[model samples]
Target: MTKEHILPKWMREEFPELAREPVFQGSQNEHDGPTPDGPRTVYRGGKEESGPFNRQAPVVCGPCNNGWMSQLETNVHEPLSRMIRGLPTVLTSERQAVVALWSAKTLMVAYRAPHFGPRPRPEVILPVDAERLYQDRALGPMMVMGLANYQPTPYAREPLYVQSFTRMEHEGGAYSYCATLRIGHFAAQLVRCPDGMYPPLGQIPPHLVLLRPGASAVHWPPSRPIRAGAEWDSFVNLPEETGT
Candidate 1:
C-alpha cells in the first residue's frame, strides 16, 4: 500500500474553492505515448518508478472550509485512489492504452489573469514569510508557505481564477492571480532582523516591493513582462545580498 498525506489547515481555511486545471498535464509513464521508446519504466533503488519527478506518496489533508478544497503533498497516494473511485474497474486495452498515473504534485491550478494580460504561470509550491513565522517561534517549529486559487477577477472578460500569495481569504477581498503573478519578476527580500537591528540603507538590493506601501515609495520591484530575450523568469528571489 502506498502512503497518503493531506494538505495544511491554513490552506483549507485560506481558499475555499478548488478545481482541476490541466494545461500541461503530460506524463512519461504511459507506454502508448509513442512507439515503444526502449524501456520507459525503470526499477531503481529497489523501487519501480515511472518518470522524471516520479510520483511520490502524498500527505493528504482535509475536507475543511465546507469541502471547497483538499490538499495532497504528492500523487503516489490519492491520485490513484481518485482515479480508481472516479473510473470503472473493468479492464480493456483502450483503457490500458490511456492508462496514466496521477501526479498530485503536478496538480494544476487555475490562475485567473489579473490586470496584466497574456497571463503568468507559477510553480505549484508556494512561498511564505518564513522569517516572520519563525520569529514568533510558537507558530510552529518549522515554517511553510502556501498559494491561493479561485479568485474572481473584475477586469477580465470572465472572472479570472489565479494562484497567488496575497489573498487573505476570510477577509472577503483577494489579490487576483493577475496582480499576484506580476509581482514576481524581480528580486525579493526575506527580512530576519532580531527586533532591534538595522542595516545600512546604501547596501540594499534594488528589487524588493514592500507589502504595505505607506510612507516611502514602498521600496519593491514592480512586476513586468519578459522583454523577449530575457535569460530567466521566476517569482521566488532573494533580496540584495548586502550585509551578510
Candidate 2:
C-alpha cells in the first residue's frame, strides 16, 4: 500500500495558509437498528495535529494512487482551485461530473483514513461503492452530489474540512451515507443510498446546487452561501430530517 495525501499536492502548493495550519480530524458513527430506536449512535475519534498537506492515509495501493487517482487530481486542479478561491468560473456538464467524482473520492479517502481515538464503526461508503468508484471513475446512480458556496466566519476558518455520517439499518448494514467537503468558499456534499433508493431532489436546500445527475452548465457562486458554524451544521445534518 502507498500513502496518499488527503489533500493533493497542487492544493497545498496553491494555498500555503491551509497547508500550515494544524487540522482537526474526527469521525462520528451512527447506527439505527431494525427496531426504530434501538441503539442510536456513538461519536468517536478526535483531533490530529497534522496539517492538511501532511495528512496521509495508507489505504490505497501504489498503482491505484499513481494511476487514475493521480489523473483525477490533475483533471480537477484548475477548476477546483478557482472554486475554492472564490473566483468566477462556470462549470460545464463535463466539469460538473469531474468535480462531483473528485468530491466523492476525497470523501472516500477521508472515511478510510485513520483518526485519533477509536475508529468509527459501520463503514460509511460501502465496499461496493468504493469498487464502483475505482472502476468507473464516476459516482454511481445511487449517489447524488450537490455544491454550494461557503462563507467562513472568523471563529471557524478552516480551508479544508470533511465530515461524514452513516445510518445503519441493523448492526453493520448501512442504509445511507452522507459526506460533506468544504474547501475555502466551495462546498460539496455527496449522499449515497441503496440501489433504487435515490433521495428526492426537491428536498435539497436552495443554497446547494445539484452537480451530479444534472446535464446543463452551472454558474459559480450561488446567490446564497452557507455561513460557517451553525448554518453549516444545519446543512450537513439536514438529511436526517428531509431524507436527502
Note the Cα lDDT for every prediction shown.
Answer: 0.22, 0.74
- TM-score for candidate 2, residues paired by index: 0.86
Give candidate 2's error at residue 29 in angstroms: 2.5
Question: Relative to the unseen true structure, what is the C-alpha lDDT of residue 25 in candidate 2, on a scale of 0 to 100?
Answer: 55
Off by over 4 Å in 2: 33-39, 155-159, 168-174, 202-204, 238-244
User: Candidate 1, which segments miss by more than 4 Å at Cα?
Assistant: 1-18, 22-189, 193-208, 216-243
Q: How accurate is candidate 1 locally (lDDT)?
A: 0.22
lDDT of 2 by residue, 13-119 (tens): 89877766766555556655456646555565566666667767788999999998899899889999998888876888888988998898888887777653455
- RMSD to the true structure for each prediction, in A, is 20.3, 2.9
TM-score of each: 0.21, 0.86
The superposed Cα distance between candidate 1 and the true structure at residue 226, in angstroms, equals 6.4
Superposed Cα deviation of residue 103, candidate 1 (Å): 27
